[model samples]
Target: MKKVNIIYWSGTGNTEAMANAIAEGAKIDEVEVSLLAVNQASADHVVNSDVLALGCPSMGQEVLEEAEMEPFVESIESVVKGKKLALFGSYGWGDGEWMRNWVERMENCGAQLIDDEGLMANNEPDDEAITNCKELGEKLAKA
Candidate 1:
């Protein structure tokens, strides 16, 4: 079975909801899923997983949560080379430039992103967005 890890940082729970939905979708594909807060996720888990789904909301002028997620991301830079990765997040504003930049950074680090990118807006997650999040998870599992 494929093992997938979802690591996320959420200030107001929107991104957490998205992460759970992603895991649910991956489960439909019979993938073993581990959902962890950014602080709870370890480098070993990331290195051992077949797929990685990373989530974080836009914070501080359209950037990643710096306290935990940033450090976790840095730690995975060398380990994630050639690994399948998916990025998802919620943004309050600023045109989702953060997600784009993040995806680009991961790509530059040699991690293969499964699709274009995943971004939801604000605090409310609509049905279509949730479905997209789930589909993203399913695709990552299949990849």
Candidate 2:
């Protein structure tokens, strides 16, 4: 069974909701799915997982959660080479530059992103956003 690890940082629980939705959709009978916070997840987990789903809300100036997520992602950049990756997040304001730039970074590191453009929901995820997140998870699991 392939392992799917979802690691995320959520300040207001918005991103965590999205993470669970994605995890729910990605669950397959043959795969092991684990959803974890940035504090509990490590670069080794990201490197070892068959599928990696990273989620974080846009922080000040539209960047990743610096305190934890940024450092974790930085540590895994080289380890993610040729890995199947998926990204999703929640934003309170501004455009979805954070998600876009994050996707580009993953691409630059030679990771295969499941979605050409990763999913981003403004503030709390609506029904449609949740649906999209689930689909993203399913796609990542299938990959």
Best by lDDT: 2
**lDDT by residue (tens digit), candidate 2, 9-43:** 99999999999999999898888899999999988
Q: What local lDDT score does residue 95 receive in model 1, on the 0 to 100 scale? A: 88
Candidate 2: global Cα-lDDT?
A: 0.92
Candidate 2 contains a number of clashing pairs equal to 0
Residue-level error in angstroms, candidate 2, position 32 = 0.5
Q: Write candidate 1's Cα lDDT for 35-56 as tens digits.
A: 9998787899889999988999
Residue 113 of candidate 2: its Cα lDDT?
Answer: 91
- For each candidate, give its TM-score against the true structure: 0.94, 0.97
- Cα shift from native, residue 137, model 2 (Å): 1.4
* Candidate 1 collision pairs: none
After superposition, which runs of candidate 2 have C-alpha atoms over 4 Å from their true positions? none
